[model samples]
Target: MKEPRPDEWRAAFAREFQEQSAARFEKIGKQLQFKLARITAEPLPAELHELFKKKEKALD
Candidate 1:
């Protein structure tokens, strides 16, 4: 088989990089969700709950 052209190689590399980046981001997001769910399931300090509410309100 013939070697891939320069453009073809570049395109392949870019596609692979994007796929890997997306997978990594997805994994991180899932981990963050799991941690947040765990934290929310337990009783939190009143100060922390207030802080979280403020932060969430600011985001809205």
Candidate 2:
């Protein structure tokens, strides 16, 4: 078999970068889930709720 060219060797690094990115996102999701679960809900103030709605609408 022929040896891989430099680009072929570099392709493994690209796949590793993507795998690392996916791991980071999964970790963040788990952490956010844990944090949000611990929040006890009190009545959200109306102004804050309105601001949250506006932010949601802007994202949409």
Candidate 3:
């Protein structure tokens, strides 16, 4: 078989990276949704809730 050109190899690498990144982000998003649901469902103390809000804002 012929060797893959540099550009073709790069393109393949980029496509694979994109696919993996997308899959990882999708999984993370689903997990975040589940965690958010659980957190929202359970009532939190005012102090703890305020801490969470601050932490989230910091991340943003």
TM-score leader: 3
The TM-score measured for candidate 2 stands at: 0.56
Each candidate's clash count: 0, 0, 0
Model 2: lDDT of residue 21? 99
lDDT value for model 2: 0.91
Per-model lDDT: 0.98, 0.91, 0.98
Q: Candidate 3 residues 1-60, lDDT tens each?
A: 999999999999999999999999999999999999999899889999899999999999
Error of 3 at 16 (Å): 0.2
The window of 10 residues in a row where model 2 has the poorest summed lDDT is 35-44
Encode model 2's per-residue lDDT on 1-60: one tens digit a residue. 999999988998899999999999999999998888767445688999999999999999
Q: Report residue 47 deviation for candidate 3 (angstroms).
A: 7.9
lDDT of 1 by residue, 3-48 (tens): 9999999999999999999999999999999999999899989999
| Error at 19, model 1, angstroms | 0.8
Residue 25 shift from truth in candidate 2, angstroms: 0.7
Model 1 poorest 10 in a row by lDDT: 36-45
Q: Rank the candidates by TM-score, best first.
A: 3, 1, 2
